[model samples]
Target: MSYIDGFVIAVPNANREQFIRHARTFDPIFVEFGAIRVVECWGDNVPDGKLTDFRRAVQAKENESVVFSWVEWPDKATRDAGMDKVMKDPRMNAAGDLPFDGKRMIFGGFAPVVSLPD
Candidate 1:
């Protein structure tokens, strides 16, 4: 089974293009580092919740949109090795500022329980 790294980020709506550019720039590196694929999804119909929800989890503001993303790797070992190399790469070191509020971003590694092929 593959290992997964998931992320939820709150990005200022105005910075959407910039954020996409940043992701586009880094996505290939994931594959280069042994990831099977990197998926970036912008919030389209994210709804608000009184108790809990994606928006609430990240404390999304009116001017911001939530981004759901993930990277798929063969396994945790490969992901760890790839991540190590990725962090050491010059691109990461020089990537400069993030277009989003990273402090509010949520992320975690997951073991997939079910996946139906499309």
Candidate 2:
């Protein structure tokens, strides 16, 4: 089964361009480590919820916007191996240029139950 690594983050609204540049630079490294595809989405219409929401999930501030992203891998084993390599790569340490608070980023691994026909 396909595996997915998903992420949700809060980015400073003023740093959209910088965030895109960072994503562009780093996304390929994930692919090199065995991710089949990566998708990053900038939130356009996310709304506030009384119970909980993307903003609350990440504790997004007034000046920040939400970003949802994911990386797909052929399978969990492939993802695990690739991620180990990815973690060992020195470039992962370069968080200085990140436009958002890395600590607040939410992420997880998932096994997909359904995917629409393409």
Q: For this target, which candidate reaches the highest TM-score against the unseen true structure? A: 1
Candidate 2 segments whose C-alpha is farther than 4 A from its true place:
none
Candidate 2 has its poorest 10 consecutive residues by lDDT at 89-98
- TM for candidate 2 is 0.94
Clashing pairs in 2: none
Model 2 lDDT tens row, 37-104: 99999999999999999999999999999999999999999999999998888888885767899899
Q: What lDDT would each prediction earn against the true structure?
A: 0.95, 0.93
Clash totals in order: 0, 0
The alpha-carbon lDDT assigned to residue 33 of candidate 1 equals: 96
lDDT of 1 by residue, 3-107 (tens): 999999999999999999999998899999999999999999999888899999999999999999999999999999999999899998788899998899999
TM-score of each: 0.95, 0.94
